[model samples]
Target: MPSNSGRRRAGADRSPEPRRKPFWRRALRAIFVWGFALALLGAIFLGSAVYMTARELPTFADLKSSQNGQMIVVRARDGTELVSLGPSYGRWMPYGQIPQVMKDAMVSVEDRRFRQHFGVDPIGMVRSVMVRVETGRWKQGGSTITQQLARTIFLNNNRTFGRKVREGVLALALESKFSKDQILELYLNKVYFGGGAYGIDAASRKFFGHPAAGLSTPEAAIIAGLVKAPSNYSPTADVKAAIARGEVVLGVMAENGVIDPSEAAAIDLSTVKIAKEGNQNSVRYFTDWALPQLDLLLPETSEPLEVWTTLDVGMQQTATSAVKANVPGGAQGALVSMDRDGAVLAMVGGTDYVNSNYNRATNAVRQPGSAWKLFVYLAALEAGYKPDDKVHDEPVTIEGWSPHNSGGTFAGEIDVRSAFAYSKNTVAASLGNEVGFGTVAAMARRFGITTPITTVPSMVLGTSDVRLIDMTRAFAAVSAGGTSIEPYGIVKVETTGGKLLYQHRSTRGQVLVPPHVAAGITDLLQSAVAIGTGRAAQIGRPVAGKTGTTTSNKDGWFLGFSSGITTGVWMGRDDAKAVPGLQGGRAPAQAFAAFMRYAVKNRPVEKFDTELKLPEWQLEPDDEYMMGNPDDYYYVDENGNMIEPGTADGAARTGPASGPPRYEDGSEGPGTAGAPPPAASEDFLDRATGRGNQPDPGLRAAPRPGTAGPASGQRPPTVTRPPTVTRGQAAPVASRPSAAAGAPN
Candidate 1:
C-alpha cells in the first residue's frame, strides 16, 4: 500500500503542471478581441451613415449632366455678347485635353496625395487634425480630390460629424465607380471660380483669356489657387492677393517635385496677362427684360442656352451716350429704341447701371403728360375728326373740375391741328369730353397701354400712371403704319449644340388703325415736331414725335420715330420731386433728337403715306408772333399793348391771330399793326435745337411800352422756343400742345 501511494503521488507530481501562457501572448490575444469588437462597431456606424446618405444621392445620369453646369449667353443682333445670365461656363474640356501642368498645379495645391489615396486619405486627415489641434483652428482641408468631387455632386456644405461620415462613404463609392483621372476631371470642371465663372475652362478664360489646354505655369497656379477660396483669390477681386496665392501654389508644386524649384522661383505671377473682363453695360436692362420671356418661349431644360436678341450694339452705345450726355445733374434718365416691327434695338434703363439698376424705361410708371395726348387724338381721329377740324381751346368745366390751359388763358376757337400743336390743356380736356373717356381709354388700350385708366376727364391730361414701355409700344403701333406691335428683345433661343429652343417670328404690320386715322395721327406728330412743342426733337429729317411734362415738372417724356425706328426718352427724379425747369421738351426732347440723329443717319428719309388737306387760312396765318422760349411767347394785344409770356392771358394769345396785323407799308406782318417782324438775330429755334454754337445771350431787345423786360445792367432773360416757320411760308399745322411752353419743348 505504501509503495502504491508513493507511485501515485510521483505520477501526480510528474503530470507537469500545465504550461502557463507567456504575458506577451495573453496580451496579444486580449488586443485581438478588443480590436475585433471596435472594428465591428465602426463598420456598423459607417454602414448606417452610408445608408442614410445613399438614400438621397443623385443618380449617375444627374451627376453626368451637371458636369457642364447651367449658363445663359445673351448675344446682341450682331453676335456681340451683351451679358451672360447664371454662372459662366466655357466649353467642356475632356480629361486628355487638360494640360499636364494644370493637373499638377491642382494636385499640388488642393490634394498632393490625390493619386495615392483610394478615396479618403488617412494620412492627410491625421495631419490636418494635428495642425488644427496645434493652431486652435481649421486651416487645412483633409478632403482628397475624390472626396471633394463626391461632396460637390452629392453632399451639401456641412461641417458636422455625420456629414463627414457621409462624405467619406460617398467618396469611397465614387472612387469605386470612377478612375482617378475621371475624379480629377470632374473636380476641376465643377468647382466655382469668382466673377460668376465655373469650371477650369471658364476660370482660365475669365482670368487668363485662354483655355485650360494652353495654361502656362503661372496661369495654372493662379487658377488652381482659386479652389481654396474662389472669391478671395480671384484676380478680378484682388490681383495682388491672387498673385500671392499663386506664388504659394508654385511653392507647393516645387515641393511636390511637379516643377523645378529654380523654375518655380523664376516664374513671376505679376507678368501673367489677365483677359479683359466684360463691360458691365447698362444693356443689362434689355437682358433682364428679355430673360423672363425665355421661360414662356422654351420648355424647361438644364442645357446651356444661347439667346439671340434684337439688340443692336451700336445703337445701344449711341443710346447710352445720348442719355448720359443729356440727363440733367442730380436727375435720372432712361431711353428705349425699337424698330417699327417691335424689335428692341437699344434700351438704357438708367444713367449709370452701377449706381442704380431700377429700369425706368421698362418698369417705372409715370404720367405721360402731353405724350398721352396721342391716344386722345387717335380717338378723336377715329371719331371722324379731321386735322383741319375746329376745336375750341376755351376753359371748360367737367364734373366740377375747371380745366384751364397750361398757359392759364384759353386760345379761342382754332383748328384741331393748332389746338394739339400748342398742347392746350383746355383743348385736350374738351376733346376728351367730346370723344368720351371710354373711347379714349379704349384707344390707349388698343395701342398697347396696359395700365388701368381712370376714365376721368383729367385722364386726357395723363393723370393716370403708365409704364414707359407701354407708351413706347403704343407709339410704335403708330409708326408701324397703324399696326399693333408687341415690343420684344429676344429674337431666338437655342442650345450651344445647335438645338433650336425658341425663335421669334415677326408679327409686324398687323393693322391696328385705319390708314386714314394713322395718317391723321402722324400728321399731328409731324406738326408737333416740325413747329410745335416737340420741335426740339427734330433731326433735319422727316421725324414725328410728341413732348410730355407732368404737373409740377416731376416727369418729362419725348416719344418719336423716324425711318421705321421709334424711341422714347424719360427724365425725372426717382422720388417724383419736381426739378426746377425740368420739361419734356427740354432734356427729354434733346435726348430723343440726339439719339435719333445717329439712329437714322444711314436710313433713307421717308414721308407719311397719307397727307391731310387743310384750309388755306390754317396754312397761311396773318398774325406775327414771337416766343421767347418754348415756355415764353410775346404777343401784342388788340390795344397795341405787349402781353407778358407765361401769364394766363399770354397763353390764351399764343396761337396765330384770326386776321393779319397791318404794317406801316400797308403790308401784313406777324405782329400787331405797324410792329415790324422780330429781328432775324433772334434765332430761338436754333438755340433750342442746340444747332447754334453759343448759349442764348437772353432777350436783347427792349420791352415794348406797358410791358416789362429785363432791366438795364441785368442779365437778359434767355429765350427758348420750338422751331417756327417763317410767316406765310406755307407752315405745317397739326395737333397736341405743350402746357409748360416756357421749357425747352
Candidate 2:
C-alpha cells in the first residue's frame, strides 16, 4: 500500500505541467496598454494646445482688415513729400494677378512644399532641427509660408517654446480656414521686403517701381531672397548683395523645377530696372536725422503721421552737388547746413548716395584740425583778451610737447585775429596753455561739440575728433547771435488726417555766449574769411569761417557761417589716409563756398553786427613775449617778398592789384610763384564769392623785380588792416625772408 501511494504521488507531480500560458502573449499585452496610454496623452496635449491657440486666433475677416498701424510721411517744409515710412504698402492684388514666376520663386525659396503642407511642413521642421543640432547653429529656419504669415500677422518674433507652439497651432488653423492660394496671398501681402516695402505688391513697387504682375523672374527672385534678411539683402542698401541673394533664389527655383535652368540662367540681375525714388535717395540723411526725433515725439503710433522737416530741397541738392564737386576722386566728403535757428536744411553724408549712405556729416568723428581753434579763440576772448590782443607766435613746449606751425615757420608775434586767420599751431598751443586746455574744451562744449576733448595742449589745434554737424551747429550758435542752436530736422508732426501730435516751434534758448562775445567771435571769423586760411569760403555777404587741415592732411574741413546760415564741410579718405596736397583751404573751403552760394541765394544779405552789437571792452596789454601790433603782421609784394610794415594804406602795397603770382608752398616766399595759381584753386576761390576783391590766395605770389606779379585783372584786396597803431604798439611788419627761410604753411 505504501509503494502504490508513492507511485500515485509521482504520477500527480509529473502530470501538473500540462496547461501553462505562453510568455510572449503577456509581454505583448503589457506593451499594448503602455502604447495606448502614451498615444492618449500625446493626443490630449496636442488638442489642448490647439484649443488654447484657437481661442485667441482672429477670423479671416479680422486678418484681412488688420493694419500695421500708422506710418510716417516726411515732408519738406515746403510741403513736398521727402519720403513715406512705416509699412509702405502697394495696391494689394489678387493671387491670380501675381506673376507665375514670382509665385514659383517665392515658394521654392521660402517653402518648397507650400502647396502640400497642411500648416507646418514636418519634413522641413525635422531637417531644420537636425541641421541646427549637427552644425550647433541655426543656419536655416523651418517655418512654412503659412506659419510665417501667421506669426507676422498675429504673433511676435520672440524665440520661445510657447510662441513656437502658438505659431504651429495658428498655422494649422489658418490652413483649415483658407485655401493654399489664399494662404499664399496673405503671406505675400503681409511679409516685409525691406526698404519700407510690405507685401509682394509693395516690394515690387519699391524695388522695381511696378506692380506685382509686372515683376520679371529676376526681380521676383530678388524680392524672394529678401525674406531671409531684409535689411542685409535690400537692393537699395547693397545691390550686389541683393543680386547675390537673388542668384541663390534662382538656383532654388531651378532645382525645384519651378523654372528651367536655362530660363533662370537667362535672367540677368542687371536687367532688373530698379526705380529710384528721388526724394528718398536725396535726403536720406535728413530722414535718418529726423527719425530719432520722430520716435521721441511719437514713440508708439496708432495712425500714419505727416512730419514736416526743415530740409530745403534746393539746399539739399546744392550740398550733394558741392560735395561731389570738391571731394577728390577716391575720397569721401560730408556737408551739413543749418539755418541760424539750427534748422537742418541740408545734409550730404557721402559723395554719392548710391555709392554709400553713411551719414558722415552727422556720424563721422574726425579731428577738427584748426577748426577747433574757434573754441580756443572764444576761450581767450572770455579770458579778457580781445581779437586785437597780441600773442607770441614762436615754438611752444608744454609738458614736453612742442607745437610748431605746419611748415615749422613761426611769425614771431601775431594778434589773436591773425593767429586764428592764419591757423598758426604754435600760437594756438601757446595761447591754450596760457589759458587752460580745460577752458578751451569747455568753451567748445558750450557750443554743442559732443565729441570728447582731452585736456592736452595739442587739443587747441583740434586734435580731438568732432562731428561735422556738431561743428556746424557750434558755428550756428555764433551765427544766431549767441542763442544756443539745437540742430533739428523735424519741425512738425501730425496725423495724416491733420490731427496735431507734435509741433516744434522755433523757440530761442539761453544764450551760450553773450551777444557781444559772439559778435567778437563773429568779427574774428569774418576776418578769417577776409584774410585768413578760410579765404576760399568768402561769399561776399560778410561771411565768417575757419579752415581746418589735420596733420598729414588726413582730414580737411571748413566750418563757416553767414548771418542766415552755418555750413560745415569735411573731406577725407574713408581710410583716413592723406590725399596728396589736400588742405582745408582747398577742397573743403571751396565746397563750403559752393554750398553756401546756393543755400542762401533767396535770403537777403545780413550782417552779424546788425544782429549783435559789439560789447564795450578795453584792450589788454600784450604779454612781454609778444612783439607787435594786431594789424602789423604781414603784407606781401607780388614778388612774394615781405615788405616792412609802414604804408599809407596800412600795409606795404607793393604787389600788383591783379592776379598776383601763385606760390606752390603756402608761405610768403619765392618758390615757383611766377605762374598763375592752379586754375582749380583760383576758380574755386573766386567763382562762388562773386567778389573781384577776394583775399590773396593762402600761398604768396612770386615777385617780378620792379614789375608787379602777373595780373589777372581783378579788384584790389578789399580787406584792410584792423587799425593803425604807433611804433611799439604797431603790428609787426613781415620782413623780407633771408635765403633758406622758405617753408610750407
Candidate 3:
C-alpha cells in the first residue's frame, strides 16, 4: 500500500534478470546426443556389412566337390613299393542310389537335428561351450550337418575363431539356398572315407564289396562311425575296433529316434558280413606296423606322403620261411633281426599275418626264458665277478626260495663259465644273490629292456615278461660294441613330390658296457655255442649265443649274435602250455643256426674279441686254501672231501664232476690223469691246475674262452647257503648238497 511513486523509485534502483543460457553447457548437451546417434548408426552399418559379406559366400547348390588326393605310398629302404594307403576310388553314386540307412546313421551320429536346424544350432553351441568349460578342453563338437558341409566344402580345416565365424555364415547361406535333401546329398558325396575311399559309395565297396544301396544297418553304422577318425575306425585297420565303434553308433541312433532301441539292441555287429580281402603277405605286416610310426613322424599333412622304411624284403621272407618250416604245427614263433645300429632289418611276427594279426615280434610280451641271463651275467661282471670265478652249481635257497637246474642233477663246484654254458638255474640264482637284485634290475634297464623288473630272487632266471623288440634291442647293445640301440623301422619319410618330411639318424647312446667287458661276455657266449648247451646254434663261424628253456618247458629262446648283426628267436605255444621235452637248444637253436647261416651268407665271418688276456695268476683256481700256496694243490677224490697232494686217496684226485667225459673207457684224457698219480712233482700239479708261472701254454688266460672274469683286485661274491629252508623236511639228495624241500618246481 505504499504509494506507486515510492515503489517506482525503489524498482528504478533494482537491476533486471537475463533471458539467454551460457554457450558451453548447451554445446556439451548437444554434442552428447549427436555422438550417441552416430554410434548407433555405425553399429547398424557394421552388422549389415557382416551379414552381406556372409551372404556372398557360395550357395549349397554351387558347392564344388573334389576327388581325394593320390595314394600315400610306403616303400622299403631299397625303394621298392611295399604298399599303398590311398586313392583307391570306386564308382560314385547319386543320392537316390545311396542307402537310406547310411544317411540315417550319418544324421544320428553326426547331427540329430539335420532336418530341423536353419544352419548353426544355438542350443548345440551353448551346450558345447558349457561342456568345454566344464571339462577345460574342446572335447565336444556342435557343428550341424549344414555347418560341416560348409566347412568341408569351402573352409580349411583349422580350429580358429575366425574360421568358425565364416563357417557359420556359410552354413546359413547353404541352408537358405538348398533343401534338406540336397544338402544331405552334397554331404554324403563329398565326405572323406578311410582306406582311400572317398564317399559312401567307395566306403561301401571297400568294406562290403558292394554298392552303397545294399549296406546293412551294422555296416552302415560302421561306415558312419568312421567320419570322426577314418584311419582309426577303418575296418581294414582294425575290424574289431570298427565293430566296437558301430555299437556306439547304434546307441546314438536309438537315442536320436533314428532307429528303435529294441532294433538297435538286436543288431549283431559281429555277424555283419564284411568282405574279406586276399591274405596279406608278411610285408603288409611291416607296413601296417610302420604306419603308426609314419603318422608320428609327420603328425599333420595335407598332401600324400611316401614313407621309406628299413625293411629288407629278402630278409623278411627268409625269416618267414625259417619260422614256417621249423615251428611245430600248433606252436607260434617270432624272429627279429637288427643291424649293428639297431635298424630293424627283418621281423617275422608269426607264421602268417593272415592267420594271426597279433604281431608277436613287436607286441607279444613273453617270458624271455634263459635269454634274460645275458643281463644277469652282465650284472655279475659289473659287480667284479669273472667268468672263471666258481660258484656252487648245487641247490641254493634264498629267503625261503630254492632254485634248481632242469636236469635235477647238480655238479658240485663249477666255474661261472661252465654254469652259464650249461644254463644251470642254481648257479644263476646264486649269482643273483652275490649281486643284489636291485643292481641286476638296473643293468637290465640300462640295456634298454623297458619291462619293469622286480627285486625278487627268481628275477635272475628271466621270470619277468619282456617284449621281443625290447629284448632284441638289449642284445643289440651287446653286439653293437656296448652302445644302446633303439630299434627303428622307418628310415625316411618324404612327400610324394620329394620334399623331405623326416629322415632318421641313428641315435647312439654312450657306451654302457666296457669294451673289455663286452669282449668277456662274448667269449662266454661263444663257449655256450661251441661246446655247451647251445651247440645246436653252431653256424660254423664265430657265433656267440645262449639257449634258454624256461621252467616246465613252457618257453624256449635262442639269442645269438655276431659282429655284424644280432638275431633273437623265440618259440612256444601261444597258450603258454608246457611242450614236453622242449629245450632251448632243440628247435630255437636250430632256427637260430638256420637264420644265421643265411644272415651271414653275404657278410664276412666276424669274430668277437674272445681274447680275454688276464694275468696268468688270475686264471688259477679260486681256492681259499690254495691262494698263496700255488705249489700246494688239492683235489677231490671219489669222496667229496679234499685230500693232500701225497695222500693215497689223493692218488685219485679228480676235477669237478661237471666236466665233459673225454673217454668212456677208464683211461683218463691227457688233461685228466687222475690226481697226477700222487707221486707227481709240485710242478706237474701247478701245470694241471692251470697255475703255471708264465701263464700256462694251455691257458692263454685273457684270450681263451675260459679266462673271463674281473679285471684285477676284484673278488667274486662268496658262495653261501640259503638262510631259510623248507619247514620240517630235508634237502633233496643229488650230486652236491641235495636240493632243499619246497624248491622251485
Best by TM-score: 2
Q: Taking the tens digit of each residue's C-alpha lDDT, what string does model 2 give over 1-745?
A: 5798898888888845577668898888889999899999988987776777666667766766676645878899899988777787787767888888888989999999998888989999999999999999998899999989988887888999999988898888787768898888878887988877888888888788778888878888999999999999998878889999999999999999988999889888976777885455658877887788666776576787888989997778767776876687888999888887888889888877766778898899999888888888877655545454456666556666777664554554445665666667777776676667898888888888888889976788888999998999888888887788888888888887888888787787778865546766887787666655665676557788888888888898888887588899999998999887677877787778777766666678886672211111111111101112222222233332333435526555454322122232233333234321221233433532223543223222223244454244433222122222222442322222222222111
What's the TM-score of every candidate structure? 0.60, 0.77, 0.65
Order of the predicted models by TM-score, top scorer first: 2, 3, 1
Clashes of 1: 20
C-alpha root-mean-square deviation, candidate 2: 13.6
lDDT of 3 by residue, 1-745 (tens): 7999999999999999887777988898888999889989976875565478567765544554355455678787799887777676566566787788898999998888777788888888898999999999987789998888877677877989999888887787777667788888888877787777777887888788888878888999999999888988888778888999999999999998879999999999988877775436677667667778866778577787888888887677667766666676678888888998878888888887865778888888888777788888887765544555556656668767887654354555555666676676776777776666787888899988887788888898889988878888887888877788888889988887889989898765779866656765776777677656676676657878787777777887888897578898888888899876566776677667666666767777776755422211111111100111111223222322333434544354345323232221123334446311111234543443345233222122223333343333322233343332353544322222111210111
- Cα-based lDDT for every prediction: 0.74, 0.72, 0.70
Give candidate 3 regions above 4 Å deviation. Answer: 1-71, 86-117, 120-144, 147-170, 177-182, 192-196, 209-274, 278-281, 288-301, 324-332, 350-358, 383-386, 507-509, 572-583, 611-745
Model 1 lDDT per residue over 501-560, tens place = 888897546677666678778878887766667756767678888888888889889998
Backbone clash total for model 2 is 9
Clashing pairs in 2: 70-303, 70-304, 629-730, 629-731, 632-731, 638-703, 639-702, 639-703, 659-712
- Candidate 1: misplaced stretches above 4 Å? 1-68, 83-86, 89-195, 199-277, 508-510, 612-745
